[model samples]
Target: MNILVTGATGFVGRRVCARLQKSQSYNLSSAVRQSGSNPPGSEVVIHEVDGQTSWQCALKNQQVVIHTAARAHIMNDEVADPLAEYRRVNVDGTLNLARQAAEAGVRRLIYISSVKVNGEQTPAGCPFTAEDAAAPADPYGVSKLESEMQLRQLAKDTGMEVVIIRPSLVYGPGAKGNFATMVRLVAKGLPLPLGSIRNRRSLLALDNLVDLIVTCISHPNAANQTFLAADGEDLSTTELLRGVANAMGIPSRLIPVPAGLLQFGATLLGQKALARRLLGSLQVDIEHTRKCLNWTPPLTVEQGLRHCFEIRQD
Candidate 1:
């Protein structure tokens, strides 16, 4: 199979390329920006991603395209028009790539979306499923949802297969953002006030997500389907922190603080949104993916955490 993966140097994209290169069945290529370098042993094509950007050179002879590039969610966006900026990349850029891929005779296009397309949080004991109506709460989520819709329409018009995988918080070796911050705090034995946060959030390991992406590449049943990817295990804030601490071979020093107080404090500090992510529930149901794809996460949560810790040590 001739596969072309965008965002080939990104956290998830790098891992995807590594996995695909190891498989003897694939002849891998990377579609990167002019500024980005190609992964070793893979063909590279440079093209800008924008309204006027062209992907003809990259899409040639490519059977599958795994799009992992995007204008990621910004925590404190200083831009005057955040939505427009996101749309320029997430929606417009994505659709442009899909249209060209379809015209180039590509067989499948796997889009890596986010669970935020469902909503910010799930009510207690309820997990977001693939069938749930999209209720994206942020601009990034909205753009992703719009791109998914556009891709489906294009698929219908071109007879090209489209497979969408919406994954929850993805973490593993070299993870940054909130997960990395938590790892640092835990390694330092800092006292965290999230002991009272009893919310359950689903997390996807990088390996698990990559595994599912690889599965979607040629799976006959995956065409025109949207699948939610997760580790099939949910953890509370307290449990997650403690698990990280355990993996680091340190004691977790968590101080019990009421979730309400935490929210209030975060609001005063202009971090209410961050507080919601830390204390809220965001669970996903991957039963459809498991049953439909006959797939299972190869790594347990503990094993994933251990991999992360070992990477940190190196």
Candidate 2:
């Protein structure tokens, strides 16, 4: 099949392209803003993903589009209108591509979305499901939700298949954001106050997420369906820290500070958002995805963490 993968330069996108290249079943091409970033000989320069960016040359004769491009989450963005910026790139750009893909006779478009579309947190024993009402808390999440809605409507009108996969925090070697920071701290053997944080969070291994995207590429059940991706096991803050430390073959120097005190300090220091992410209970239920697609994460949480560190040591 002829396939076009967007955002081929990103972390997840890069991995997807590599995995697809290994398969003889696909004639792989990648969309990028720059040259020499994708696989050698399959790069299509589609400048920026926006409402006006043209995808005609790239979409010609392509059967599937795995869109992984988006304006990713920003920690402390100082922009005047963050929501507008996010919408312009995430929502507008995504819909633009989908419309053009449908016009070009693209059969399927698998969009890589975020679990943030389900909201910020879930109570204990309660996880966000694909069927839950969208409750995006931030501009990025809102834009993703908007893109998903637009894609669903476009699918309904154009007779195209749209598969949306919402994944929780994704981490592996070279991961950024909170997971990276935690890894650095654990490597240094610094004492962490997250030992007492009892909140569970869902996480997706980079490889597992890539595997899911590949599976959905031709899975009949994935068409016009929304799936959540995760490692199936939820880990608490303490469990996560220890897991990393153990994987790194080091002692975990975690302090038993109460979660409340940690949050209070973070609030006073204008890091409330950071604290919530470190101590929040964000979980996702991928049961529907498993039942519908007959799939399972290829790695357990511990195995995933071990692989994450093993690559770093390499």
| Highest-TM-score candidate | 2
Could you give candidate 2's per-residue lDDT for residues 134-162 as a string of tens digits?
99999999999999999999999999999
- Output the lDDT of residue 301, model 2: 87
Q: List all candidate RMSDs to the true structure.
A: 1.4, 1.1
Residue 230 in model 2: lDDT: 98
Per-residue lDDT for 130-184 in model 1, tens only?
9999999999999999999999999999999999999999999888888988888
Candidate 2 — which pairs collide? none
- Listed in order, each prediction's TM-score against the native is 0.96, 0.97
Question: Candidate 2, which segments miss by more than 4 Å at Cα?
Answer: none
Off by over 4 Å in 1: none
Clashes of each: 0, 0
